[model samples]
Target: MVELQARSLRVKIAQQWGSLGLPFLLVAVVILFSFLSPVFRTQFNFLSILRFASFIAISAVGMAFCIMAGEFDISVGSMMALVGVLGASFVPVIGGFAAVLTTIAISSFLGFVNGIFITKLKIPAFITTLGMMFVFRSLAYIYTDNVSVYIDNDFWLYMGNGRVLGIHFPIILMVLCFVGGYLMLRKTPFGRYVVAVGTNAKAAELSGIHVDRIKIAVFVMVGFFVGISSVVISANMGVANPGLLGQGYEFQVITAVVLGGTLLGGGNGSLGGALLAALILGSLRNGMNLMQVSSYWQQVVTGSVLIFAVAINRLRYTLMGQEA
Candidate 1:
């Protein structure tokens, strides 16, 4: 009995170590940078890093739900562009609040369409989302005639540039999103159904879970948050350049999620973890900026991080003989 207890303790320790492995590495990076650069530890620098991280982190929050549900939405970047262009273009006539609602509503519809194609039409989530990515991307250009849109709203500008209770609007939004996602995933039935369907669709269906409907619902939720992200980005940047906006954003959010100990294979994720990863990535980028890292090198670094994170995650799963 003592030997069995010892084995159990060993296994439990290993499990915890595995879980914290990513955050540990992240902390290591922070320490290394703090030594290499004087700006790394400054409160102002970290605040700026968090502000930039908020944009990508916010998007990842939405993407997390779909990913945990064993589905993916590559078109969220395009959906971001859609919101920016749509909101910027229509605000002149329809008014500011109306424009926000309209843009978000349209993006939600787009997400609904994506989910339908994947679940109802049986096109597969990856393929459907990938195809829709191009479709929405092209639509952004066509709708805008390749022109940038701008809004001249004072409240929007203030939200983008102003701070509330000493916190930036984008950061506040990111925190709220992370909190909401964490609660939903940890304390709600919908989250359970998502995991059930992700673990085994046939079993979930047998158990009376509407797997496809859940997928659709999650997709819509993802798109809805993506719509908000567009506004944040637009407000911060002070322009809506659809042609350039949201480009590469999808990959960035996906990379952050995976790096945070979320498995790409699905049904396992943590909004808190993903948010932390997002902050790490943003810090890395900010550090790179201070060090004057080249744009091409940044891509190389991102790709390397993605490959390393995914490889480690897959290996952990293989060794565990189940979900990690």
Candidate 2:
């Protein structure tokens, strides 16, 4: 009995490590990068890495929520562009504060529409969101007339650049977003509903859980985060260019979330994992830049990482005798 108990304890420890494979991988990546680049451990480089990681992590938090609800929002990239363009357009008329408010409201409404099409019109989320992506992207171009809209407001710039207690405001906002998302998913009944719907939507509906409403709420939540990211991106760049803003953002955010152990078919997710994965990705990109790697190679490396992560996820599920 003593031997059996010891074996059981060992198995349990192994399982815990298995569940944390992504985080372990992140740590390994950090160590590798630290060895590869002399500047990787510098304070300035660390803060820079954190800033980029924070942006990706904030969006990944929303993406994780959507994936956990068994849905996809490919429109996130275009949504950011549209929000930036619309907000820039409003700045000259309604002032910066109101423009930001209106932009967020519009983003929320578009997200609601994406949910309505998927839940009410019986469209697949992938299709709905993919179509909306192009629609918003086109609208952004038309609205901006193919030109960059520059906002010279100090407040808007501060949202992206201001530091509090030596930490960037965007980094603070990112931490707040991750903490709030983690708490909601772990402590709230709505969070349970999200997991339930993702685990089995039909069963969730049969259980009298408003699955559609929950799904819509999830999409809206994603939209809110994307809206915040849009503001930060535009502010950081000092201009809102429909053509340049949020390009390939959806891919990066989704990659971070998936790398964090959020399954594609969506039964499970981990906010902590997502944040760590985002940091890993940021570190990888920064490290490559330090190494003077080509931009094309960076894209290839990122894509390869996503594919490898998915394979690891599949193996993990299979090892645990669970369907991915």
What's the number of clashes in each of the models? 0, 0
lDDT of 2 by residue, 77-181 (tens): 999999999998888888877887788788888889999999999899999999999999999999989899998877777778889999888899899999999
Pick the TM-score winner: 2
Sum up the clashes in candidate 2. Answer: 0
lDDT of 1 by residue, 233-311 (tens): 8888888897888998898888888787676667777677788789878877888778788978977886787688777
What are the Cα lDDT values of the candidates? Answer: 0.82, 0.87
Q: Residue 225 of model 2: what lDDT? A: 87
Best of the candidates, lDDT: 2
Models 1 onward score TM values of: 0.93, 0.94
Q: Candidate 1: where are CA atoms >4 Å away?
A: 1-7, 17-19
Worst 10 residues of 1 by lDDT: 10-19
Q: Work out candidate 1's RMSD over C-alphas.
A: 2.0
Please report the TM-score between candidate 1 and the true structure.
0.93
